[model samples]
Target: MSVAELKERHMAATETLNSLRERLKERRLQLLDTDVAGYARAQGKTAVALGPMDLVCCRILQGHTGKVYSLDWTPEKNRIVSASQDGRLIVWNALTSQKTHAIKLPCAWVMTCAFSPTGQSVACGGLDSICSIFNLSSPLDKDGNIPVSRTLTGHKGYVSACQYLPDDDSRLITASGDQTCVLWDISTGLRASVFGGEFQSGHTADVLSVSINGANSRVFVSGSCDGTARLWDMRVASRAVRTFHGHDGDVNSVRFFPDGNRFGSGSDDGTCRLFDIRTGHQLQVYPHPQDNSTPTVTSIAFSVSGRLLFAGYSNGDCFVWDTLLAEVVLNLGSLQNSHEGRVSCLGLSADGSALCTGSYDTSLKIWAFGGHRTVI
Candidate 1:
């Protein structure tokens, strides 16, 4: 065929495929009931008013020499474990801002970290493609280092995110750049179940984040570079329970709502979306107003009641959104003592009294309800 004819034929084929995909999506959505957002509006639902004094930076934990990439709070809510580019994982007493344990990592490129439910151990992973566990109860070596108690290895690409199963230190879940999520038997250091592979219905690109349902440990959601978030059940490793599509860019983070029946996802599209698990429909979309620059969302967390969504952006803006109203109720980045660099990660304390955010400025700040008007 002539060059012009060949190019025309290729363009036509691409258009046909795109059209087909959209039709399928529409058909699937049609089967869902009324969206949650519409129902809320019809019922005249509104979010509680929050003022600047409602939440304030209470403490700043500063010890890392390099950018802080990730952090997690202990279930007891008094301690925090942070991983930094400095190649160190420091466990801090959030109240006193004291470092109780500072251990050097074998791999410096760590991207994610989590505190076990009991707070007795911490898990972290990164470019090493392995999740390393450190037991705080273990004695330090003669070199003054807390050794890795166990390492879960199998991912063919970088380990992007990791989280311990709720109340079960013996099990963990990890998302990887290899476009898969794996459940690991922590004790045996073997794969308990692998979700998504050549024979499975999974993400086509890198799986960047995973959040397990607090209410039901069997269910979890994952965000990926393919611009989709998928719901998976640990019991069924061969296929995803559902695949959610809406974002125009990579889904950077996925968080389970406090109720566990819904989830929130932040994407490179500069938007955060709420999806209902039961109905398989997107309930709401929180979009940042377009300006000269739209920063990517790096991480997100939800308040205990699921009323507030805390999203961290690449421009160092930590926006607190009213989940019900889909409005920016407060900008933690504009507050006094905010981070000087990008907000890389954030999490709420188990009690819902405070929030801890890690930044590229090499510091983590704790924010708590400040005034009499306590709005979590």
Candidate 2:
């Protein structure tokens, strides 16, 4: 190596370090001069100032060998549960990037998983048509498998999604390919009520997603391949209160708005729609550009403030939409180190600080806002 070239490189490194040190000094000075709480209050008033495009790829959680189909962040925002086609359910400590539990499933085709509201347990189901619950606090069996505390088996088809009721782990809702959504009594492992499947009150195709109302727990909604979303009441499970229609393709995912007065649905048609539960009106529609082909919308989640909508696409793209503007605010797929295969599912941490996306690439990526750093 030439001495001149080495000296040039050394000078460049030194210049970069000095630049960084200057920036740090400026930041420290700004912190010292600013009113911290007032600044924080101002920041909190604007929910999510930085869009997904502004977010750096903070963590790529790699472990699953096959496509990760589903993931859920516990309400505590400290843990995540993911179910993969590799026949495993992984419980992750979100802060530390450590696996707390890696359970071997009895079946390999697992589709969905959800953590209880209290974060005490996890439930998952798939092509086996069974909803299995695992007590996270229980000791593992000698084989290192977490023993299943109960298995609810009444679904006639693959269980597509499962979620515990808000503030109540004793009950859960499960959507199925059988065109029905069931409310289950988790304590007894019995069916509480079947929400659909009858000629007059159910989806004509598979029920793909369900979202229980956070405000009024008795009411919940389901999205279906029938291209419709139905609102149902737990007290009257035999019939739907309203049937929402607009999508031309299968409704793949559904999620309640933070207020619970309305819900959103993502469809294979590459559009996400919002519907009002009371008026039964189609409130808004978010569609991909007409200039290019669209990818199927695989999953959707709402930010805690309901100001943003996160939609995962089959082409490995995750779009963040401004709820008020109804336009794509950011495309995570265009970013470096983004998912390489179809994005199968996505979810937001309870605190709304982190967004998680799972993909056919057999990995998950956690994206956080400007100041938060997830433990590696």
Candidate 3:
């Protein structure tokens, strides 16, 4: 080979080596950034901090004259829908802390409320045994009260909880004190499927909470006063596919983990348990130190990544538990400005950036990681 050709090849190899080194350096920096953001999400924060995973009260939404029985955040994260025994369902602008609209129900015993998937409507039900639906764009009456667009009738007892099916807002599921969970088709205003009744192999007592699996919308699980949690398929509502027995008292709340293969339940037994749906086994139980009185878990919510479980107790205590470690990492009740009465319901925002809790004290509190974060 000629000496000139040898020199040219040598220079080419050196340039190639330099380019490879630059790419490797960029990759290392990317990995470091990812590690930091991942740590923040796993620790339930936006940045690395020194304290425990805590939720600071950013807003205390007032105006309800009666107990706030249920609250749900809209998909836009800027609005909230709350139901109260005051016979009103109020939609609030969380960004401005203003009541955007209020609907007066014919029945004053409203218990549960939920925002539809599209954020265009709201559904609520209670002691009237009728689930009422209202459209936000519809014209309001002189009193700023909107008329019910649809009224779902047929539940034999008080409706305890109602939620829209994920991805499909036209359908919803409602649990009732009648010991039944019914899937309703809102568009047709008819019952689509019924899960339990006196003849069905279902809960012997009232069904309190129902959680539909987002991964497979055809399946859902319910917690009942009979001290059991049952999984049912929407197609075959004749009976439950699996029954979980662990809580010694009534299971008040049930929420699906992110993967939808597992679920968490809070019970009157003063214990929160994780159940594996596929294996039909109890994975873990979260129990507090015994005292003279035990607090019943009233509501529960799972984090977006399924790493944390937020549970509200009847004693007005809200706990954030580490799913893998089975530890209470944060206690909102111990914090200042916490609820003074029973926490009836709680929900995590769509973006997982905020949480809202409704209480029997007739108020709702917005909680997040920062102290006094501006709503805007």
User: In terms of TM-score, which candidate is strongest?
Assistant: 1
Q: What would the per-residue lDDT of candidate 2 be over residues 208-296, giving only the tens digit for each residue?
A: 99999989999999999988999999999879998887788999999999999999999999999888798776667888774477899
lDDT measured at residue 103 in model 2 versus the true structure, 0 to 100: 88
Clashes of each: 0, 0, 0
Enumerate residue pairs that collide in model 3.
none
Model 3 misplaced stretches (Cα beyond 4 Å)? 1-54, 371-376
Kindly give the stretch of ten consecutive residues in candidate 1 with the minimal lDDT sum.
Answer: 31-40
* Off by more than 4 A, model 2: 1-53, 290-292, 371-376
Native-referenced Cα lDDT, model 3: 0.86
Q: Please write out the lDDT profile of model 3 over residues 224-331, one tens digit for every residue.
A: 999999999999999899988778899989999879999999999999888889977677788755586988888899878877788998888888877666667777
Error of 2 at 89 (Å): 0.3
Candidate 1 wrong stretches, greater than 4 Å: 1-17, 27-39
TM-score of each: 0.94, 0.84, 0.84
Question: Which 10 residues in a row give candidate 2 its minimum summed lDDT?
Answer: 31-40
Q: Each prediction's Cα lDDT score? A: 0.92, 0.87, 0.86
